[model samples]
Target: MPRVGLFIPCYIDQFYPDVGLATLEVLEQHGCEVDYPAAQTCCGQPMANTGCTDAAVPLAERMINVFAPYDYVVAPSGSCVAMVREHYTDLLPLTNKLQEFQAKTFELCEFLTDVLKVDSISGSFPYKVGVHQSCHGLRELRLARSSETVGDDFDKARQLLKSLDGISFAELTRTDECCGFGGTFAVHEEAVSCMMGRDRLADHRAAGTEVLTAGDMSCLMHLNGLNQRHAQPFPVMHIAQILAGRQPEGITPVNSTDGSVA
Candidate 1:
């Protein structure tokens, strides 16, 4: 069992702690020695995404120091992991330690599949699922083949979910479409973001998705806001939650009446 340092993103840490807990559950269940460093905080994705590399540097350095002792650093979020693996180049200079950190840090599914070599998970979800391919997960991490590229159909999320006892997937018209939650992108582009999110949800609804799941909760968070606000509501859960044997009961939905759900 590899000693895993669990890196929960800021949104998952603050808004959707359940997702973080589910990630820890799944890792440990699969024979990983997972530890949540209380000192852990945001991976500086927000600042860096907004062209504030200087502001993100301290957080990045701190993160490297905090998780250095562990054999591997894993996170439930692809975007956050992508920030460490890709964007750290801008925030910090190239060094042996930085390179080592980037190489070992992985998103939850990648860690399970690549490190653990787990092709199948002993879990089950009976509902039809629609997977929202997160931008960072698809593009940066290459967790799945993008629609823009012509290649064999391979999806890490689907691979694990397909192994479940009774679960089906919706063959979305656009499988690798972005959920319009690019961290600060959703805030700055609210109207476009809302429309894009609604379109993704509608695509899933048309394809008969009973439950919506994704590797990144930030994507699910944006979609769930629209999920609860819109007419056709469905349960939204993190992939880790399903992989950990937890059933979705609208875990990500907000009341949709106000901004009360923070």
Candidate 2:
């Protein structure tokens, strides 16, 4: 078992802490000796993405040092993991340790599939789950094959999710479309972001999706917001929560819907 340091992204920490906890649960189930670094904070993806690399430098450095002692640093977010892997070189003077840290930082599904060699998951989530392949995960982490690429297609997240008994996958019209939550892109272009998000929501709803799940909570966060704004929210959960034996049926508002027309 690898000694893993959990990297909970800022959004997950403040807004969706349960996702962070669920990620911890999933990691532990697979025999990871998990430790959450209380010192761990934002990895500065927002700042870096917005061309403020200088502002992101200190935060990126903090993450590197905080998780340096662990054998592996695992995060539930592919976008955040992509930040450490793809963007950190611009933010810091690269040391050998920084290089190694970049290589070893695995998204939760990647850790389960690539690191732990997890093919068969032990759980049951019998619902039509609509898969959202966020940009960072699809392109950066290569968690799933991008639609534009030429190759035998693959989806690491779907592979893990399907391993659960009785899980039915919703056939999305556009499988790998962006959910309009490009970190700072959403903040800068709110109207466009919400429009794109609603499009995603409509696709999922049309597919008769029982629950929507994705490897990256940020994508789900954007879609979930649209679901709410339309006054017909379904249960939107992280893939970690589903894999860890949690169900959307257990939600307080019964899928966060208010008995209104969508």
- Local error of candidate 2 at residue 108 (angstroms): 0.3
Write down the TM-score for model 1: 0.93
Cα lDDT, model 1, residue 258: 51
What is the TM-score of each predicted model, taking all chains together? 0.93, 0.93
What are the per-residue Cα lDDT tens digits for candidate 2 across 1-262?
A: 7999999988888899988899899888889899998998899998898998889999998998999999999999999999999889988888898899998899999999999999988876767789899899889999988889999978998898888766788898988888998988899999999989988989999998878999888899888888877766788999988888887853332222344321
Assess the local accuracy of residue 92 in candidate 2 as a C-alpha lDDT between 0 and 100.
82
Check candidate 2 and list the clashing pairs: none
Number of the top lDDT candidate: 1
Model 1, C-alpha of 99: deviation from truth (Å)? 0.2
lDDT digits (tens) for residues 147-218 of candidate 1 = 889889888888899998667788898887778877888999999999999899989999988899999999
User: Cα lDDT for residue 199, model 2?
Assistant: 89
**At residue 95, what lDDT does model 1 achieve?**
100
